[model samples]
Target: MNYLKEYNELTAICPKTYIKYSEPMENHTFIQTGGIADIYIKPKHINDVQKIIRYAKMNEIPLTVLGFGTNVIIRDKGIRGIVMNLEYLNDITVNENEIIAGCGASIIDVSRTALKHSLSGLEFACGIPGSVGGALVMNAGAYGGEISYVLKNAKAITLSGDILVLNESEFEFGYRKSIFQKENYIILEATFQLINSDPAEIREKMDTFTALREEKQPLEYPSCGSVFKRPPNHFAGKLISDSGLQGTRVGGAEVSKKHAGFIVNVNHATSTDYLMLIQHVKETVKQNFDINLETEVKIIGEE
Candidate 1:
């Protein structure tokens, strides 16, 4: 395929879209690791996203949707085709007791928006670092709250460029799983149902949660947050700590000594290092506890 020709066409479709050829994924991901993406785009408008999606489908080009890259690990060999980073789509607004956030809006920012509006329900997400899209994909939660508890509906685009509005019932939310994970749909925005609360009370809750995160989580280094899902009746971090896997290293990737759930990139780690360490953690935990740990973070791209 003539990538230059495709790039020019995409630019034409969305002249203001930030487009790059042979873009480095390492620069985009929070882990600061991964190989290159063939074509990278950060579309500024929702219309641009639709147009790009249609163009890719018409051209039979593969497209990958990306959020803030907080809970994902791209392989070292990198991804082929188009990688669309939705960061530029971030927009947050409040209406009555509801908040509408663009898919690319930071979950933390969304929670803050809730607070600004004196809205309750998103206090649990005050410290989550992923984008709204990522949170919806994983049904992300913390401190006794999850996305399913508050999400009313979401706007999305099909792979074929058709738009959709999925209500909460249609979300099919589970433990860190949502329909978006099973379907070829790109989340565009979300509406969250919340309740009016005292701003001071909401801020207090947010402060408490944020403080707990800082005290318990490893925030010093770059890492994909929480490598594995919570096993039934067991916490992944607790299990890893019990199995004595913390501080275990594969190259620069080490199971965080601070938080056993995280594998930190302490020394310019490659995706291979992260994956190997993850595999090691899973194997050791399975051997010791007979609990098969499933990864929570999304791993994509070639080997």
Candidate 2:
């Protein structure tokens, strides 16, 4: 929709920043399989983020804010309008047991910060590959800890450029869901409360979780980590494995042999390949058993 013209207008407001026309989504995503975006921008400042959002809202242009890519699939035909990436907002600071983290800060980095300072609560997140904002938006958790438990509050910018400080309860977090998912809110920074612990203990815990993830998950391949959420009492991986879908391939997208839950890009897989492979596995599992596997990963963009 003449994104070039819109991009020119945007640069007039927020100049001297990273902006790209027809930027490849594959370069931004973890799975490395997506189409070109009409306009992709990485705002340098919070005011820049606000200005972009306000501009999009004022002009009735579509806007999609993204963090460090994980747990999302951008479709093969690409996304329309502006794709605002928050990767450059990364900053992290510690204040005793409280950690102030920018939306773009990696969850792993936060965990490491906790370890560095002998904080304990973030040890469970040592293996996650999401940014702070993405984790907050999704309530991302691992090894029995979720963002809801540790989050004190978050600074978010509304679509109209108003700032809102959301408390933990406002997050409405549950099983990979949060208010940010339902509302037009862009996370700016997150405050988390952790606990003091022995440095050795924290390091040991982080190391253990890291080793476990490396051992069980298909870390060697390019893929969305876990394709499906655990349904009821059944584990997603066990269900896929029991359905005999392990090592199943669809145009270079293969259900991981090591971990059935992962769909890896074994070859130069397309977005269609991943989506098709996910559908095939879902159908097979549903056919073999009665359970319908709901995807944990968010799929976006167009066909």
Candidate 3:
């Protein structure tokens, strides 16, 4: 793809410090295996983001949005047109019982802030590895709690550069899904409603959750957390384990020995390795239990 014209137009919108051509996806993703993006930029502010959206739309460039490089797999062929990494928009503020954070703010940071303010709602996110926008978009949850419980509202921008604010009801949250998934909108910020609690108690709860994650998850290896979602009445990990697929390896990608839920980069794993392992696990589990396993991780980019 010829990106020279688009590059010039986008560069005019933001400083050179925020723009790059052919940025490596390996450097941004958690699993660390993918090709380069034709154009990548980190918008320093929301206005800059709006400018880029307008520019991309005006130029007819395919635009992709990235958060903190967690919970996604970009293919070997990488991405075309423009890719915007929202990491620079990291900002968090607390006003009484509400905590407001930018799309790029790390969930860990948000959880820490919650602990500082003796907030109880974000305890479920202490161990989550993605950004605020990602958590809201995927309806991320753990330890019997999910984002839908605390998220009061979210602000997002559309493909055509129109900004919209969605309340809880419009969020359409349901088991790892939000309206953001169904619409082409880029999340800008999220407001979470938390309750007052003893700081000591909040800290204890966070510590317990962290310990559990360490014990059950394959934290030692680079991975895209859980590979599949929980089936209607059964757990994905238990299903894979029951099928004797734990510790299974394909290229460098393996169903984690520590937890069958995660597919880890045990060696020099490529995106293809991860994809193959996922397909193999799905097929194997389907044949064994007559139930199809659906992936929870979002896979994107070209082949």
Off by over 4 Å in 1: none
Please give each candidate's TM-score.
0.97, 0.98, 0.98
Query: Tens-digit lDDT track for model 3 on 177-242?
Result: 989988967999999999999999999999999999999998999998898999999999999999
Q: Candidate 2 — which residues are off by over 4 angstroms?
A: none
Choose 1 or 3, whichever is better by lDDT: 1
Ranking of candidates on lDDT, top first? 1, 3, 2
Stretches of model 3 off by over 4 angstroms after superposition: none
Q: List the RMSD of every prediction in angstroms.
A: 1.1, 0.9, 1.0
The clash count of every prediction, one per candidate, is 0, 0, 0
| CA lDDT scores, all candidates in order | 0.92, 0.90, 0.91
Q: TM-score of the candidate numbered 2?
A: 0.98
Please give the range of 10 consecutive residues that has the lowest summed lDDT in model 1.
Answer: 1-10
lDDT by residue (240-282, candidate 2, tens digit) is: 9999989999998999999999999999999999999899988
- Candidate 3: lDDT over CA atoms? 0.91
Clashes of 2: 0
